[model samples]
Target: MNAVNDDPNGDGPHHDGPHHDDLRYVYAVCRPLAAPLAADLTGVGGVPPRQLTHAGLVALVGPVPERDFAEEPLRAHLEDLDWLSETARAHQRVIDALTSVTCPLPLRLATVFRDDSGVRAMLEDGAERFHRVLERIDGRVEWGVKVHMESEESAAPRAPADAPRPSGPGSGRDYLRRRRSQRTAQEESWQRAEAFARELHETLSQRADDSRLHAPQNTELSRAPGRNVLNAAYLVTRADSEEFVELVDRTKDEDQGTSRLRVELTGPWAAYSFTGDEKDRAE
Candidate 1:
């Protein structure tokens, strides 16, 4: 196996040495030789991440200099919002490029290997499992489907009170009661919306090879003006992607309601959330 170690003095974020750093990190793995080299995409971060091919698999990676990524700095930087956002965006950009060309097995955040040799060893050791993962996701893409309830203000509630006033010493109890009532109503609304989302996922998943619900990121809730009820991604055959999108559009039209929770679908993307090295026989 060929080992391509990170260039110590490479023009990356943390450039400080001539001796190869054992702290290289692997981002994604795709079909060997078949995968695009690091130059294809523009606007990727952390210098130009390269590809290391082993057997029939290639790992996409960038140099993580020992200094910047040392435990203390790495931990401190991870807690910084701007740093995390940029890192995530850069990572996604790489994933996007690879997925556009071929099925890629995306590594979770913070997946760092000791060195290029370590990366190659992993590809070689896990060659069979990796092939199986590729087989399952080959010719397929992932699509994100989210259902959210419109803002309560936008979907004006029928019941309204002038204002809330504390009655007596039992004001705390009254507050709790009001909060409970509000929660109950919200829960009911969310349950209904979730049911619809599940039905939509079921219909589409039956036609898809795989489907999974990702934990709703708080950013989704903060950015969206509505309450996000479901966050899901479906691994669909390229041939069926268009049809699946059409189905989602059609379902949205059919399920029009006063509280009209919205179902938003995005992507003919690489199946990042579905494939993994480990296999669940029951799956």
Candidate 2:
């Protein structure tokens, strides 16, 4: 793969310079190929993406502002949720484009090299590792399964007349009792949710080539209903994606009347979860 700035206006970064404002942001590495990426594919900071080759490997990278991506500055930017979200989306855009045409070994978000030569050197050093991961995911893609416990409706059958009432409007004693009951119900719901999540993960794991369990997303972050009990990713062969989708759909149907558990399936994503050693395997 030859490195050529995709920009047509002649304002892209120069291969050689100490401008203190430009650095190479790497998105992924893959075996060299004949075809080029889409003409309009851009990467971090909206810079035109290009590639750098070394030995049998090629890195997909784009220019990012050094002031915004440098080690110290990048750390600061990471603390700002808005900055991190935008940058991560940009990084994934480049990786997503590469994955459509090749099995790319995705790099972590905000992975920047001093320059093109730095990217080449890194590729040369990690050549074997990259090849191994690429081979493992060559014909596969990632899918996500999330299980949330919907808030229980308040329509359960009322207890017998002789049973003690839970509490009344806003009295002090009633408030305390309600709080205690609420805590107990929440705990029980979570316990049941965990068991359901475990079984769901196990069922899908049997159909996937690889699987990972990510930490549950916070409510604010996920905007999901009730509580998140399972956040898992599965790597399945392209040919099996349809079967996997069907299986999840069936599970959702089974939950319709028996439980508050709601299963959400998403994907055909780049194999993000399967490529890295940083993920926790579902046990």
Candidate 3:
């Protein structure tokens, strides 16, 4: 939707010129390369992403209407959940495209500048910091690991001998006792799951150059069979990825018979978790 120009005059903050004196939506910054991105890769507003280089750093940017991308208008648009989600997806698409061929320093979603000169200025000012980060993650990729507690129903059915005796009619005391036992079992199960998650994270962290633990997602978001207990990211060199995967598989297999915790590994993504922490971002 057009973010401005609700009036009839039609002189909105939106720029309507070939020069595109509008705001620039920045997707990422990376080491200088000879060629541009693929023809299919596009940025915000469905515009072809362009490259701006300064001090050996290359920024991927695209023109966006100032009416929709300026500080105030952008903040308002972000409050619209649908708009925000779609925009975030679009932002990630650009990052993904760059990630496929280069180690891009992904900007946060909706990062914008007044023009290409502003982007160039940022690159000039932060050139050393950018290069340091780029070097650190040059040959590495990120992986995500999560552990969840398996649902009780999905576990192997209890054998007849292990099943609890049902409280007969008029057996109040027995019913109360059974309820207490069930609650205790559930509490113990959750504790065990947490312990397993910590153990798994520790094991995997040893195999990675850097590691970070993110808050576990809720059931609705995770959509997994069990309660999510651990959510983490690992930075591993491309050469060591296979060994890392193998270690995860072996760890999960060993825990299968002893615990109802399941482990999941996903990645080779841009090093989002290991980009030198939140403090390193350009303001």
Q: Whose lDDT is greatest here?
A: 2
* Residue range 1-283, candidate 1, lDDT tens digits: 4644332212233333223763656668777544333443432245556667778677877766666566777798889989888878878887777777778888876677766677888888888888889888988999998888876556766655776566889999989998898778767777777788788778888978888888865745469768777788988999898888999889778754545688888897778677763455446
RMSD of each: 5.9, 5.8, 8.1
Displacement of the residue 135 alpha carbon in candidate 1, Å? 1.3
Q: Which digits, one per residue and each the tens of the lDDT, describe model 3 over residues 1-283? A: 1121111112223223325657878888888653445666656777667666678777877778888888998999999999898888888888877887788888888889886668878888888888989998887889999888877656747669878766578588878887898777778888888888887888888989889889888888757888788999999988899999999888677745435888888887899887774565444
CA lDDT, every prediction?
0.72, 0.77, 0.77
* Best-to-worst lDDT order: 2, 3, 1
Ranking by TM-score: 3, 2, 1
What is the C-alpha lDDT profile of model 2 across 1-283, one tens digit per residue?
A: 5354433212444433234557888888877654566667666777766666676777777778878888999989999999898888888887777777777778888888888778878977877778778889888999999998876543246678899755555677878887798778767877778888898899999999999999998977777767788999999998999999999999887744434788999988888888755322332
Clashing pairs in 2: none
User: Please, what is the TM-score per model?
Assistant: 0.76, 0.78, 0.80
Clashes of 2: 0
Candidate 2 accuracy as lDDT: 0.77
Worst 10 contiguous positions by lDDT, candidate 2: 8-17
> Among these predicted structures, which one has the highest TM-score?
3
C-alpha lDDT of residue 278 in model 2: 33
Span of 10 residues, lowest total lDDT, candidate 3? 1-10
Report how far residue 277 has shifted in candidate 3, in Å: 4.8
